[model samples]
Target: MEFLFQILVILLAARLLSEVSERVGMPGILGEILAGLLLGLLIVEETETIASVAELGAIFLLFTAGYKEVHIEDLKASSKKAIVATFFQIAAAFIAGFALGRFFGFDFVESLFLAVAFSPTSIGVVVKTLLDMGYLSSKPGSMMLTSAIFDDIIGIFLLSIVVTVGKYNAFPTATQFMLLLGKLVFFVGIMVILGYRVFPYIFNYVQKMHSKESIFAAVVLIALFSAYFAEIMELDAVIGAFIGGVMLSNVAVAKINDIQSKVSGLAYGILVPIFFAHIGMAVELEALNTLGSFTILVVVLALLGKLIGGFVGARAIGFDSYESFIFGSGVMPRAGVELVVISIGREMGIIGEEIFSAVVLMVVVSIIISPIILKFAIQKDKQKNTSVPAS
Candidate 1:
């Protein structure tokens, strides 16, 4: 009964916060996060459950990301440039993050984890912001979108490598990690080829059941089962969720969108808020106010590595300098994805709670800075495009 009551309070609080935030200019997620912070201040223990829900939020979030309309043609069209841009972006971020982690006295595995954390592009913020700003059809927008997708793929691969190779504070024995990688690769390859047959059949069976709840229920099965498969195999559930979503997304594109809508409602309305609030709850918000100079230095350097790597990568592939800045900024919304990564690491005992807290602080700060920078860069470019003196 207490569990039920806590869940109710979390849902109501998250809804209230989201509604209020949306009425103003901010994203509803900002409100949900703040709501979690409020709960942290008032009822701290509830936060652990909330954190669990946040994990659900992450699963649904990534599923929806892969579910949105995408086709082979779309991938084919952008694959060339995306490849060039993403290669350099991952290489640079990984190297820089690893160096910084070691410099901070972390061992090889920890450094690898840090590198993986820095490596991915957050497509959610960039996509939502672009669509909201009515720039979805613009060339830069498409380019950014394509680059972001490739970064996700690269990020997943890097994360799998990090998790398998850098299990604790040392590197995985090459033989063991390589074997794990082989199973993963085999699973992914088989799914990519066979999902076209299996997922469509499964989805069609669900649709014939003739109930809306059935679709959402099917989504739950997919999420939970896929997540479990990874866990039993000694892999992170988020990786399984991502791979599952991507495989089913293309084959069951229509159902994916419908499932995505319902999933989003749940996440935003309840799960996600609980998750982020737990993050804030775990934090003594005041501690952030007093981080040491050296910690601050590490933070700044990490930020610089991302910004420069993103900008240089984008610029290399024909984006103008300012446009490259926008590209990098768009990728900087670091909250949701990083949370998923950190949670898994903690559960596996690969990282302690203290380090987890520090990483969360890093993500929150980055998330705050990313959108503002992205919006500015885009608006500035739009002004430039429109302000030219014509003959």
Candidate 2:
């Protein structure tokens, strides 16, 4: 009964706050996060069940994001811009964050962890904003999604290197690094090949079943299986879930579309909101306040690093100033991957509580700010295009 009550309160608060946020023209996630923050301040204890649900929320969120927003063929075709932008974005952010950490007196490993924390854009936030604005299928949206996917892959790889070096107190040997990379490539390559060739036939057979929920059950199973596979391979489970969704997308678009509402209903109605709120609830407010200036600096660096990296890359690839700004702003938010990196760093003792709190603050602030900036840039670009006569 106690657990039930807590769940009820959380769900109600999240839904109410999300509605308010949407009514104000902001993303509902902002309110959901704030709801979590409020609950954290008020509730004395958080249950393990809640935590477990939040974890599932994150997984389902990523899976839904991949299913809806990303297409592998499209990603491959437009790989050029995404690759260039992601490389520059990660490099710029990592350097800036490392420099900031060093300025604050953190040692080499700690500074590198800080750099990794700032490097990945949270595609969940970016995708939600794009979807809200009806731009998910647009060119800028495609670039943002693809860039974010690369951002996660590279950021996670860098994180593994940082963690290994921190644990051993020495840089990994060249051969060691190559082996890690090789394993990652092999995992992705095999998943892609099998997902493309085998999974479609499996799903095709499943689709012939008369049970209304059979396809949905198959999707959930595949997502969970891929997620487990990735974790066992020492990669992030969210990455596996995303890849699974992408593969399923290629095979069963029409069938999946048929059940999209049912899947989305389950995710958004419960799990995804919990994930966002949990982020807010996890903040250590007192620690954040004590490290206020440092927190502000981190947030500034995080925002500028991604923005400038993305903007410059987009411009280099011939995007107009407005489009470039939109792309840059779209990729500026740091949430899911950043939080995971910081958690790993904390567990490894590479970062202390103060830095953890500050980065959490950075995540919340960035989550709030990035969507607003992206919305403004997108609107401005639309107005500019509207004002121009068709060539």
Candidate 3:
């Protein structure tokens, strides 16, 4: 009963602030985040139940991102560009973070973990922004989405290295690295094969069931199963949910649209809001009182790392100046994987409280600011496109 009441309060606050945020011409996500911040300040400390629900929110959020916004064909088309962009983006962020840590007197292992924490773009945040702004299928959007996925995959590898260093006080052996790589390849191959060859048939049969919302139930089940599977394989649940969504996307059943509609309702109307709000709630605002300069440096370097790296990669791939800017801005947000990495570090007693707080503050700042810049870039590009006369 107490937990239920807490959820009621959270939902009410999140939804109300979201509407207020939209009215003020900011993204509703910002409002939801603010709501959480306020609630955290006034009453709510992070609880296990709320955190679990928030994780579910992230899973459904990514699932919807994959299902409704990003397409497999688009991912394939942008694969090469995304890989290049991701490499540069992660490299820049990692280097900057490591340098910052070292300058702040952290040891080598701590510096490495700090670098790894700030290195990945938050896919859920990017997807939400793109979906909200109707840019998910655009050229930049496709590139951004693919690049973010690559960032997550790289983050997983980096996390393994950092964990090994933290736990065993040594680098992972080549065999361990190769095993992780093999697992990644196997997971992707199996999921892709199943998505293309099996899911459609399953959904077609599911649609014929007399049970009400059976297709919806089946989708939810698959999403949960995929998320659990990913966890067991040492990958993020969002990745599994996303792959499941992509697989279910191609189902050509009669009520496919309806199924998507239901999923969207559940994801956006409920889970996703909680996810964003939870991010805000998790922010250690008081940490900034002592580490103001450190927090600011983290935020600035984190943004610049992705922006400069993304720009160089996109330009190398032949994107023009403005387009390169869009690509850079699109990849600037950090959440999801970064938070998980820092949390793990803290749990393992490697990351001190002060450092953890600084990173958390940085994540919140990046999440709040990056989307606004991306939106501006997107809108500016639209204006430029419209002003030009057709040949």
Candidate 4:
């Protein structure tokens, strides 16, 4: 009964607030997050069940993101720009965090963890924002999605290095680092093989089944399986889910469209809301009381780092100024991956509570602010394009 009540309240609040947000020219997620934060003040404790459901929300969000909005060819086409963008974005964010840490008298290991925390762009946030603004199929959107994927991969590698240093007080050896790299390569290689060569036949057979909804069930199963496989390889599960979605995108079955619609409905209408709200509920609002100049600097630098990195990378690849700004805004929001890194660091005693709180604040600010900036940039670009005569 208690669990049921919590779900009921969360859903109603999220939907109500989301409607309000959308009517006001902002993304609905902003309201859903606010709903969670309000409930957080009253609920006091989050149940494990809620957390698990939220995790599924994220998985399904990424899975549908890949299945519906992004095609394999889009990913391939954007690969070069995505790589360049990700390289600059990660490098800038990492440097900013490290420099801040050193300036504040932290040692090498602490500084390294700070750098790792600053480097990742949240796939869920970026994808949700792009979907909200109807830009997921655009060139900037494709690049953002691909760049976020690479960011997660690099984040995993950096986290591994940070953990090693924190636990053993030394950096990972050359062989150890190589083994880690091998795991990443193997995961991507297997995913490509399975997605291109194997899953097509499997899904084709499933769709032809007489069983009710067999294709849908198979897709869900494959998504879950892929996510689990990625986890065992020390990679993020969202990556696996995304790859699974991308792989199934080329299935030529008649019901593919229906399946994608169902998947999208389930993800966005139910699960994804819970995911965003859960992130909001996790915020310790009291952290605001502890904010200082250093915390303010951390937030500023974190946002600026990604913005500059994305803009520079996009411009280098010949994107116009407006397109570059859109890309920069798209990469600014940090959530799940950043939170995980800081939480692990806190637990391992590699960073103090002060640093952890500052990063959390940064995440909150980014998720709240980035959507508004990105939405405005997108709208402005649309207006500009429409004003010009077609070439």
Candidate 5:
């Protein structure tokens, strides 16, 4: 009964706040997060069941992102820019984070974990904002999505390395690094074969079934199975869920759209909101109060690192100044993966509450700021284009 009431209150609060946020020209997610913060102030307990549901929310959120936003073929065809930009973005952010940690007197391992936390762009937040602004299919959006895919894969791999080293208090040997790379390659190769050569045929038959939800069921099963497979292999489950969605994206466009709508309804309406709220609830407000300087430093570095890296990479790939700035703005927000990285670091005792709280604050601030900047960039671009003389 208590659990039921908790869900009810969270849902009601999230919906109301989200509606209010949208009306005020802010992202609905910001409101959902605020709802969580409000509830946290009012209620002290966070149950295990709530945590489990939140995890599901994250999974479904990524799964739907892959299904709706990513286009593998498009990513492959124009991946050069994304790859280069992702490299620079990760490099810049990682180095900046490490420097900040060292300045604060953290040990090498802790500094490295902080670096890893800042390296990946959070696709969930970026995708939501782009979709909201009707830019998900624009050139800048494609670049952001493709770059984010690489960011996630590389980030997770780096995280595995960091966690292993932190656990043993020793750097990984060459052989250990090779083994990790081998595992990653093997997973991708198998997913490619199964997704292309096997799953389509199976899904084709499933689509013909008379049951109303067969396609949806099959897609969910595949997503869950892929997530389980990745977790068992010591990689992030969201990675698998995302790849699974990408794999099935081209199989049955019409039926997939239907399934996507239903999944989106389930995710956004309930699961995803809970995920955002959980992030809010988990924040240690007291830690933030004590870590004010550190929080400010992190927020600045996290924003500028990704922004500069993205801008430079986009320019190198031939985007004009305005477009490059938009790309930079698009990748500035960090949330889902950043949270996961820091949470794991904290659990391993490699990061204290202060650093964790500071990063959470950074994520929230980035989330709020990135979309507003991106929207501004988009409108500016539109005005510039409109004023240009016809060729």
Candidate 6:
């Protein structure tokens, strides 16, 4: 009962803060994170539960992103460019992060883990920015989405690798590393192949039932259950849920969209806000204060890494100067999804208190700038044309 009450307070506070931020022309996520921090300071002990619940929000956020953003044709058309740009971003970010961490006196595993965090672009932030800028239908929007999808895949893999390395001091032997890699690959491959084949059949059969409630129940069951199974496979549940959503891409967009809309209402209206509030609860004032300077430096470097990486990577893949900036800016935000990775690192014991505090603060800063960064870059190219959506 106490927990439930805390959740209610958190949700109401977050909603109110979000509204106030919007009224002031600031991004809502910034307000949300700051609210979490203030609450965390006021009620420090609740931060743990907040972290855990927000973790679920992270999963649902990913699933929501995957469900909403992917379009097969755009992906297919831009496959080559997407692949090139994504790899470049991954490599550049990883190396830069690795170097920075080592220079900052982190050990091999710590450096590697931080590097892995740096390497992946935050997909949810990117998509939101794209939608806000009205660029979801434009060429740059398509590229951003494609690169982000690949970024999620690549980032997850890098994180898993870093976790494995952290577990073994000198790095696992080649054979052992490969074996773990194989297990991960097999797990993801089987889920994707089998899931794509099964979900459509299940949805079709459920459709025949002709009951809205039944259909919704079935969808919920599928999404959550798939997420559970993914967790069991030593992968992120959100990844599973996200994949579950994408597999349904072949479904009737209108119907699946309708289902997602409903699912999202429950998710966003109740579950998701609860999750975000939990993120607020988890912020550590003392640790963040201690690491304030370092945290700011990290936020700046991470932002630059994403920006430069997105730009150089996009240009390398044949995008023009303006488009490259779009690619860079599209990936500037770091919020829900990145926090999920940090939570996972915490769970695995790879992220200590200092790192966690820095990440939470970094998230706050990055999210604050995400919209502005995306808008500036976009308008740089289209000042005379229709404005891009900068959601």
TM-score top scorer: 1
RMSD list, candidates in order: 3.3, 4.2, 4.8, 5.3, 4.0, 4.7
Clashing pairs in 1: 36-277
Query: What tens-digit string does per-residue lDDT give for candidate 4 at 1-391?
Result: 8888888888888889999977875557778878888898887368888878787887787677566655556545656767988898889889999999999898888888889889988756666667877899987888887897577557656765676567655565788777766876798789889877888788778867999989888888888998899778766666667766766677665236787778778888888888778766766655655657778988999999998888888888888888888998899988766766775676567887667778877886887788888889899889889888774
Clashes of each: 1, 0, 0, 0, 0, 10
Candidate 5 TM-score to native: 0.83
Cα-based lDDT for every prediction:
0.68, 0.78, 0.77, 0.78, 0.79, 0.71
Model 5: residue 212 alpha-carbon error in angstroms: 5.2
lDDT tens string, model 2, 257-359?
6678877887899988887777667667887788778888998998999899889888887789998898889889887667667755765677887777787
Instruction: Score every model by TM-score.
Output: 0.85, 0.81, 0.78, 0.75, 0.83, 0.83
Q: Rank the candidates by TM-score, best first.
A: 1, 6, 5, 2, 3, 4
Give candidate 1's TM-score: 0.85
Q: Candidate 3 lDDT (Cα, whole model)?
A: 0.77
Show the lowest summed lDDT stretch of 10 residues, model 2: 249-258
Per-residue lDDT of 1-391 in model 6, one digit per residue for the tens?
7677777777777888878977776656666666776776776356456556776677677666666666556566757778888887778767876787787787787777777777776656556556777888787778877777677656656766765676674578989788777867776687678556766677678878866676678767767876888767656677677776666555662246567778788777666776666666666677767877767767777778888888998888778888888888777666666667676676777767766777677677776787788888878878635555652
lDDT of model 2 at position 262: 72
Q: After superposition, which runs of candidate 2 have C-alpha atoms over 4 Å from their true positions?
A: 79-82, 107-110, 122-171, 210-212, 253-255, 318-327, 340-352, 371-391
Residue 45 lDDT, candidate 2, scale 0-100: 51
lDDT of 1 at 350: 74
lDDT (Cα) of model 4: 0.78
The candidate with the higher TM-score, 2 or 5, is 5
Q: Determine which window of 10 residues in candidate 6 has minimal summed lDDT.
A: 248-257
